[model samples]
Target chain A: MSLDTAEVRAERAERSGSRAYLSLFKALGRGWIRDRSQIFFTILLPLMFMVLLASVFGSGDTAASRIVAVGDVAVLDGADPDAFTVVEAFDLDEALAMMRDGDADAAVVQDGATVRIYPSATNSTSGAIAEGKLSALVDDVNVEVLSAAAPGEPVLETEVEEADGGALRPIQYLAPGILAWGVAISGVFGAAGTIVDWKRDKLLRRLRLTPASVRTFLGAKVSVNLVVAVGQTAVFLAVAALGFGLQLSAWTWFAVPLVLLGTLAFLAIGVVIGGIAQTSPAAAGLSNLVTMPMAFVSGAFYPLALSPEWVQAISYLSPMRYLNEALQSVVVYGEPPSAVLPQIGFLAAFAAIVALVSWKTFKFDEL
Target chain B: MDAAIEVADLRKTYRGRRTGEIRAVDGVSFRVERGEFFGILGPNGAGKTTTLEIVEGLRKPDSGTVRLLGRSPWPHSPELTGRLGVQLQASAFFEFLTAREQIETFAELYGATKSRAAEMLDLVGLAEHANVRCEKLSGGQQQRLSIACALVGDPELVFLDEPTAALDPQARRNLWDLMRSINAEGRTVVLTTHYMEEAEALCDRVAIMDAGKIRAVGTPAGFVRDLDAPTKVTVAAGQLSGERVRELAAGETVNADETAVVFETRDPRGLLTALASDGALEGLSVRTANLEDVFLHVTGREWRG
Candidate 1:
């Protein structure tokens, strides 16, 4: 009879353990959804970044460059009206001041036949484009003068062809990077801050007294995070497609799995931070210290091709880089799912390594 | 049948950067019988919490053997977990969860039904406040809610650590009644508290602990009786003159102030009868040794808590 009772108890424990896992999942998910601040930081903040960046650098139609023309130069008449928005300046100093104040991208001073152009130092990219446009216009004027001298002479022409078969707009690349960053922030900060708070509040100690297994507890946490990740992906893609004119292909569906993998990688890092940090503030600070710089270096805000070689090399160290690259491949570049296998491999390995570290450091009781 | 809890020579040491080595629990041993309302009473830093936590399997003692319901509690014995309920000194709940949600979650963790959770809330007189978030609950209410969550599992053994600490007198009294009812259900209760009156009122057996060790363990009445201390009887000083005081004091110690005359005697009935015959019972007051006096006698110091 005693043996039978023990068997019955064991069976009951097993049944309850499974039920506990489900309950824990539901409870955690509900808690996360109800927290107003967490929702803002993890979801709304990234979506806001997407909207802000897409508005500033989005679309195929580039804004005409603003230039301060110091004097009435005949060459200005030959410039492409659509490419330049000329603002008249009384003197060279005024033009230079306008360029300094960022009111203009470039300043053109026509001194007789020789015209000198000064690009704005602060706004280098647009300034360089403006300078190139003005230089081409001056070359066209010179060619017109030379053609009258030598009538019917053939001129050297240059034609441009896109290597990728089409122009990939900045917004197309930026949307995926921003989406990856959102996943990272949600995974890392959510995991780290929650763990530290739970530890400090003695919730973890309370949990230690329960019959629930660690596997069940972590399984619940990961499930809730994954569900939230899926929702985040959906909202991000919908806004990017409908509101921001971000094009999507059939391969974009692959972003779901990639985002989930990336979330796991970041969550593993979060677990490590949570295990190490003794306070919530410390966890937040550490998470920011890790993720903020990684966002830039991993090309979440800009392209890696524009960065120096050393920076691009360092980007290899950030898991966000792999996530961004994988997302960009499927979402922006329209590559097949198989093209992201290497990035998936890297994320999986990173998560595994950091998870081991977290396991080593995590303590159920403060004592 | 197995004892509900058996702890043997438990030792735990903490190394602090400034305090050096602190022996939190050193060579502590005790047993709690089935259905026993046992209390470990001590002042702050007396190792009561460390000892209780070790027994609850929340912390691993540096060296000890603890058995809960006939199985070792260390290394996380799952079979023993469902049989034991623990209410930690600090009450922590899932953030933003209502009282009902917190208890239900605990119930699920223990494999108990949600109805059992609701019943526990009612048992603790928190049924009406079930919808309030746990953080918004008053201190006493939170404590009661924690206790409810602890009992939701319906375990045979319950561990309560300073459950009534910081509560107002009325709340403390209410919690005391709640504790008594829990024990009345035949569950073995191991309570660690610094409140002498609390232990004296609720515990069947009390262990006076100080300096990381148990000074003595016995029923409250047994300890006080074995103390062999005298009871005091006092009367107005003007009612008894110096000559009368000398005559009345036969073999007991007599002390007289300008306001009162006091006598300490082992036989309180004899002294009271003599005072009554002398018509000296005016402004009379009788004082007997309680658990606090027992603690002072055993530990050779006044009780700090």
Candidate 2:
């Protein structure tokens, strides 16, 4: 009789597909968590970047230049109140004290016709901005004095108005971009690098010989990446709130879907790069080629509005731009979820389309 | 007598950069009987691995059929894979997982218990290093771990490609012993190697391949016995001069030097009788051709080269 009897055949066919998938997922997840280098790239490095970028760009009086005016400062005339916040000191000594103590970025002392402007050198950016606005105000006062002495006099005077809710610091605008940046870096490089490493090591080749299908393998990988992405977003948001006293809107809960969608979008892109690149080094280089430029143009570190109009137009092509806009709307503008529905829709569609493309192109086969 | 594997006229072609179309496995055919240790021996670029991959269902043959365990390997029938174990030439596992965990994970894929993983690891002599990461293991240890993974499912037929390629001599011998033990349990094994000695020592029957074709197929002793090469006799030059040895063998001398005198003869009996009568031929020895010589005579190239 044949050794392949009914009992033997039934025993062989009894392999559990779910257990196989769980095995792969558990193994990959353990590797991701245990490897110090992967953790550094996925979580620690991004968290470090958020802290560094937020501190540099989000903190301090990046909102508006603070000016302390003394005496009858005629030089302060016809200046845009939004340009600087001008405050009064009892005398030149108190104004100098305020400048010394960083309470004021600049001090203006008026001595009759001889008006003198003293700015703190330590706060050079703020001091320079205040100096420029005060110089224009002095010119306007001079024009008023000259015109009044001439025929048909038109007296022009300037009043200092404090900015509502104070100045907008660099950190205020940058907090959302930093969050988006964390998601992009971890999702793109993390996924692509891991896939390339698996290929280079021949791990995928080994797994192909088993009963596991490609769908099960990729499903496990995507599930792990999504979990890691969500965890990273939560940690960064909490740190941003605690460290910087960031005021996030109740609508900030929408960032969860935004983060997940953003992850899927970048993760799909990562799969495409990993599929095309033949080696780990090639994948790393290509990932940098994509993410480095996207970080700059997508307003991760700076506002796209500050860039040239053409560059701003190009930002529309970046998925990071949409994600950043959604996050900023929720965190900065405190806009309702309806305000970001378009961004959410675009990101979801982008993810679905790219994921489909990735599914078509991705393979365990060699390039 | 059932065939554990039956491959017929298998052909797989690949497009090469400068070589145009390269036939990796061209019309290769062989059968591995159940419960036998079958080996495929060849030098580098000899298509041994390609053919084995086709049999394992990892690669598709352009035009042919492969039946493993009485089921077609192509069309991705899991009946074969479920009962077949495979160890690729360079198998890699997750760098962070311990050897025990790696084996257990594979066992879980086969629906086997963790205890079975431990048993396999113990069988392969990796029990001591069970907690060690795969990346931290030595080359031989890693090879052993791969073998353990292959056996974790208690497979009926196993495929091992270059399992002992770069191992030390002792490790290779240990692996041979392990294979023998596995075969003793009525499991069939299919392995590929360029090591003629490994094939001679481990294989019950072997197919010698060259240029993507089987040059010869037989047992180790059968190949050597079938070769037309003659037996050789060598004596110390001080005992028997080359001239004297050649005179007795009558132009059957194949090689000689000042230090030794050598002669080739179809029948070593008469030559030895003559040499014994001479009595001066001390330190005399007779040698027969082996698989290496058979390879040279059959394929006209060194077995390794």
Candidate 3:
């Protein structure tokens, strides 16, 4: 066969994508650390809160030390004496009295049919231990349980583990709340605000004139946002586990994507806000219009169960609600995604549509 | 000859939802031969920017065609984009960036730029201030920086819209030198200005645009000569009547302004001597035809100042 060759005249297309991605990473990574005040608000403060609260609230997974009787109460009323402890009444009264003083781990006093159940909820571990131990001596015993610990934490963390359904740390109920809040603040506020600043700075316009593709630009931003959010989440997860001993180790896989989806959804929202805003102030205004009501009304800061019907209904419109709910269900109740897949799908669908709108509305100029 | 850039019957009208229609650029047409420094001069809101934007492939015309290097600019794809440089009118800059950083950044935008950003700064005479932030620079310095950005890609066609708008005298001269140097390198320059003096100084040829239409196009001298009443004969004369001045000229006579009677003429000596001997004129001086006089005669606007 005769040797024949065809020459190729390749035009420049691949460079656009590579250059655009590099710019995106540079923008996101630098933007994250560059503003020291923002870093503290978005990263450090939230991380500290997650760790401290998770540690203090999540320590309910324990079996207690052997029991000692109070000064007045001699023994268990049951005929089986083996179950009873015969400690002196003076120390028992002193111990029973210690419930108020934080000396005794827990104490029970005779009251009516309605017994006062208290461990220091302030001391979560102790509260859990106190509640668990009282149940063991429930029938025929008039009991007043008192706690010296504050509402958020207990010294002996036990009731959650031996509770009827499953053992869940308080942080389990709280992780989703924190993650959703972080994503909303960081993703929506971060992305939208940054875009506005970039436009104002002419950095974005400069990039638009370049060969950078839209897909590459957006993908890089999302990647950078996801990376920052993942780092923040890692800090939160670490704080929750190590600080409060709130174990979310079981549902790591479910948690990962749940967190990712929340971040993706908000980041897309940020793009939409930034794209549509005429100025940086306008972008901030846009974020405030959405974020303030969300931070207060959504379950990010507290349970929305007690909120008015309309308030709860309003939360349904919020992306935060779905994300927080999804996270809480997985971490707190160990509920699978199927139960909240509809909400996830809704969020994903909203994100897709918003992403498209952002792409469309985002002008290289102020158009 | 195949012009490097060609346009035919280009028209553009902007539509507002409530305000209805405003025709920014009415049907306009012109062409530029290869390696020509062409200037389009028009007053603000006279569709100068719109015309330049359309030709640069930045905006679409309502009706007509623009072919850049024998290619329609409407699609404005990257293949066509890389071949030209555009400095949009009143385009904002990233003030925080140093001049050198600004040049390097723009250079990176081009797929493979062999342009020496340092050389461009040197050409603009901004090498010493390369490290200074753009915002700290004077108005003239910024204008020079804008020019440097436009030339960073070693572009074949450069569209400089009001390139010297805010420049000081010295800066204008520096820019004029840079522009001639770029032309000497054989790059086609299409610029916009309201400065008749600048058009005369910088352009190889000039196209005077008015209210979205190109009124005339030729060399600077030709454009002035092509005006309806192209000639001027000034005299330190008593205020003469509109009719008494008519018989003094080769073509016709008209009032130059409040105190001057400008009579259109092929030969000013004939008209001047007649008035001089008759004592109808005094302090007589024949002025060479200029683009400003041409603009005033044609468009009825004092353009040079």
Query: Which regions in candidate 3 have their CA more than 4 angstroms from the true location?
Result: A1-12, A23-175, A194-224, A231-260, A271-276, A329-343, A357-365, B90-101, B113-115, B126-143, B228-289, B301-305
Q: Best DockQ goes to which candidate?
A: 1
Tens-digit lDDT track for model 3 on A216-302?
656776787777877777777676667666656355557667777878888888888888787878988898787768866787766
A1-367, model 1: which lDDT tens digit per residue? 2555777878877787789889999888888888998899877898899878877776224878888888886689866778888989999899988888888999988889988999999788889988888888898889989999999999987788866538777678889899989999999999999888877678767877888876777789899999999999998899889977788977988999998899999999998888889898999999999999999999999899888898899999999999999998888888998998999999999999998888887775552
Q: On residues B219-300, what C-alpha lDDT tens digit does candidate 2 reach at each position?
A: 9989987886888888887776556666787767567677777778987888888888888566678889888898888799
Please report the TM-score between candidate 1 and the true structure: 0.94
Please compute and give the TM-score of the first chain of candidate 3 against the native first chain: 0.64
Candidate 2: tens digits of C-alpha lDDT, residues A221-306: 88888888888777777777887767777887878888989999999888888888878789889989998899899888888988
- Candidate 2 residue pairs in backbone clash: A57-A170, A57-A171, A58-A170, A58-A171, A63-A168, A78-A158
Cα error, residue B305 of model 2, in Å, equals 4.1
The local lDDT score (0 to 100) that residue A128 gets in candidate 1 is 90
Q: How accurate is candidate 3 locally (lDDT)?
A: 0.70
The residue pairs found clashing in candidate 1 are none
Per-residue error (Å), model 3, residue A139 = 15
Give the whole-model CA lDDT for all candidates, comma-separated.
0.88, 0.82, 0.70
Comparing 1 and 3 on lDDT, the stronger one? 1
| Model 3, position A332: C-alpha lDDT score | 60
